[model samples]
Target: MNAVVHFLILLVVLSAAAFILFLLRAPFWLILLVIVAVYMAVTTVPTFHTVYKSQNLRAIDRFLLRNYRKPIFNYAYNIGHGTDEEIRNSLRTIIDKSSRGDARHVYSALLGVHSGDGDEVLAHAGKINPGPLRSYYYAYGTALNGDLDEAGRIAGKITDEWMKHTIYAVIAKKQGNPEEFRKEAKYAEDASVGIQHYLLHHNFRKMAESFNLSQEGSSMMQLVENTAVELKDGRRGLILGVRDNEEIVQYDVELGDGEIITVFAEEVRRPV
Candidate 1:
């Protein structure tokens, strides 16, 4: 039986018992205690079943069920360290269970790209009901697979100007066309922060190369290390090292206030 149905039956039975006790002139406090106990059981049992008794839940789903918050950071951390099969299974679970929403679609598409399965991304995109955003994600998958022209054609179908410009900027960045990237960046400023940070990192490496210094051991590297940076969470930290993982760059930082934390590179910026 459904847990909710079971809870409703239990509630009806307890209410009947409480009513019988009242008619029999039992102590008011004792009847009230029974009612309270029934209420607590009804509320907690369903939650317990959802969190602990559900069968075949993926690790991420289990964490979400227990914590009641999307474990995005934890997922990223685990993906960075997990084996390929584990990562794929987790992503597949997320794609299957997440509700239809832009963020969910973006995550699914990105995971497909990260897993080097552009076809899967496009297949998922196609399954979404027809809409401009659906076309945009399909374009994004194509762009990730290095089909810039086709991606551009699909992006051109988007009616929302901001969405169109943002996706075009992504395609331009992937194509390594600085002029095109800048042109798209003008209209998509808010959407381009991460891409801009990635480009800035690339340019910094180029500058280091021009000066005949090792990219990892240059003056720029020293500056990045010594700089007191502000993280996205608004905590100030000094960068300890950068880990350029396959999916994203992470900065290992020691916060001035306390504790060591790993922040995404795009989230760590020098104080203005």
Candidate 2:
């Protein structure tokens, strides 16, 4: 709707320019330059206005700002180029005023800023329309707030087994219970389980080693880490770490682009 209106305005402006040029007997080159200038101003002015008045912009305008301007703002914020208060206000406005799609992206980015009050952000996210994504963040925030029971209850609303288990694994880690962490990690039916398992064992090697596996089990674990394997998701990644969580063996894999992911022993295939 906004695009249609903007297009119509452009057409009217061009028609008016042609009429004025005819009345003044303007030179053809001068008329062409005027039209180009008007076109540029019409297009450029709105973008500047939208960026400057983002909180007042409509949903579509906010979406556009998120895609185009937010990244630049985030970069500036990260490098300490922007004042902390200014950055916080801008992000808070974006989270509060933007459409759901735009708000979600901004919220995710805002989570990376350590100085922000996480509980406050989670409370804000809970007020948004109910969604699995929002619930995921809310549960994570609850866990971060040290409310494990509340986090677990919120995570229970997640129907996806992979996501539920992943959140549970995180909760387990926060509780510092290796056994519970391994139990939840085992329930994760995706590469995420591998990552969580790696994080747990890497961070708590002594507790993980106390499982007391046989020498053969140790050698197999070492081999799993040394080998490159194809994940069930079809991405081939080199195993960077391995964990023997009782009966489950999880491997940390680094993909070609250097993303650390996880995969189960069963997910591994001989590198072709």
Candidate 3:
């Protein structure tokens, strides 16, 4: 796969060989082997750190975004993409069922089409009660439809700066201003909006670097990755209007393209 993975695998092999040699009571060679093994381990620390950062902080997540996001589409693709009616119908069906995984892609699919599909996605969101997904839908939905009133209203209620900036960038995209998008994307330390905006100009490598990753940064990594996919899928970001009601009270997430999604537990309505 990647260079970092290759390095780790190599480390494993060396360690294993050194262990076996020690077990065999081998004399001079075993000592030499162990020394080499120790040397390799010690020398590779910085590389490991760098690679770890690159993996969790940047690469894998961006790679996911590059390949799997389905919401947004290339600007030119909007012209002759799916028909308005088809897009509308699909948006309705998907949003009505809105599990965590499918949510982002549904948004992605909406962005991929002409603005008509974006309208339909919001319409579907309107039918839901306030909760986590609905929270996201409200903001994300408004951005897609060029409904600045609703978008701003929803964003005003969100406390998370990352979500706010992400939505701001989306609004900028709909309004046709890359500069504004870049400004919003950079609002968060974890979110490399600066890099995302650059990549929007089509520099994927730089985007990956901005998304640097590590074990502890997996969540941020996934966010970058999901954001990347949104870019790839023709969707930029999502807007959710959250309310704490009987139906929903926690955050829910969906992986890009509907493959691996996670959301909070669904509210169970009991008969009175």
Candidate 4:
């Protein structure tokens, strides 16, 4: 838009230049203005549409960047495992262009959602994690047996490579920093766990026995309490999966004759 506006201004300036020349009966100046104006009009229209398309793409990219791929990594992990599904698959298909996470190439996936609607996108965010990673915050990692003094010390001095966020929040409180504790807690919470994330955290993890090949993803998400294998029907979890690259394995989270609660992502269309 800014470029288009500047181009129009340039045309007006050329016109004035031509008008001044014509006042002195100078030749070629008037024709110069006309050519500039015609070029500007033709160029601006298509550029405007291009800009409009870009804006739509940014809306989707903002949340999926390095600043936010943990969730998406979680999403992909889910889809690859049991929680992974058709909806998640469709979302990844939009890549106005995917530059392997480059900034300028973000529009590559702007139409990832097919339409510009915040509510729907947010809804997807919620379904992915429900309410942050609160459930994953267990006492064992903070301190054993809920012993405050020991727990406080461990939490205060935590520096684990894997669960840094969760451990740091504990340490922050021991240092008597409420602000630090809150901030770190949220980070730890949001970064809690996703099954697929752990599975594919590295190409090596996929080859290791720790990551089950049967689940088809990074099993690290299992470290956090709630992820791919969620409890269902007051009995067991409804683990999901893909069969021979063609079928969706489902779980019955809630089960009874007439009532059932199933948790899985649905596919959304990509925009043309």
Best by lDDT: 1
lDDT of 2 by residue, 90-201 (tens): 5565556666774655464344333435576476556656676667767767777788899899899998675677668768877777678667655652333222322222
Worst 10 residues of 2 by lDDT: 213-222
Q: Which stretches of candidate 2 lie over 4 Å from their true place?
A: 1-117, 120-124, 189-272
- Whose lDDT is higher: candidate 1's or candidate 2's? 1
Off by over 4 Å in 4: 1-139, 142-144, 160-165, 168-181, 186-272
**TM-score-better candidate, 1 vs 2:** 1
Scored by CA lDDT, what does every candidate get? 0.59, 0.57, 0.45, 0.36
lDDT of 4 by residue, 174-210 (tens): 4655566556555643453333123223222322233
- What is the Å distance of residue 125 in model 4 from its true position? 32
lDDT string for model 1 (1-272, tens) is: 33456567887878897998899899999999888887777777755664444332233222332232244433432332334565566666676777877557666766775576778789778766688768877987888788989999988989866568866876767776666665665564333332232222233334234334343322332425434455667666555567888988877776543356788878865531
lDDT tens digits by residue: candidate 3, 1-272: 33456568777777677777778877976678676866777567644453333323333233333333232222211111223454454455544555775454545444433353555557656655555445556677766767876887887677766556666756765676656655664553344333233232232222233344121222221322222222333332221213356966432223333233322324212100
Clashes of 2: 0
The candidate, 1 or 4, that scores higher on lDDT is: 1
Ranking by TM-score: 1, 3, 2, 4
**Residue 61 of model 3, lDDT score:** 33
- Judged by lDDT against the true structure, how good is candidate 4? 0.36
Per-prediction TM-score to the true structure, in the order listed = 0.39, 0.34, 0.38, 0.19
Task: Show how many residue pairs clash in every candidate, following the order shown.
Answer: 0, 0, 34, 22
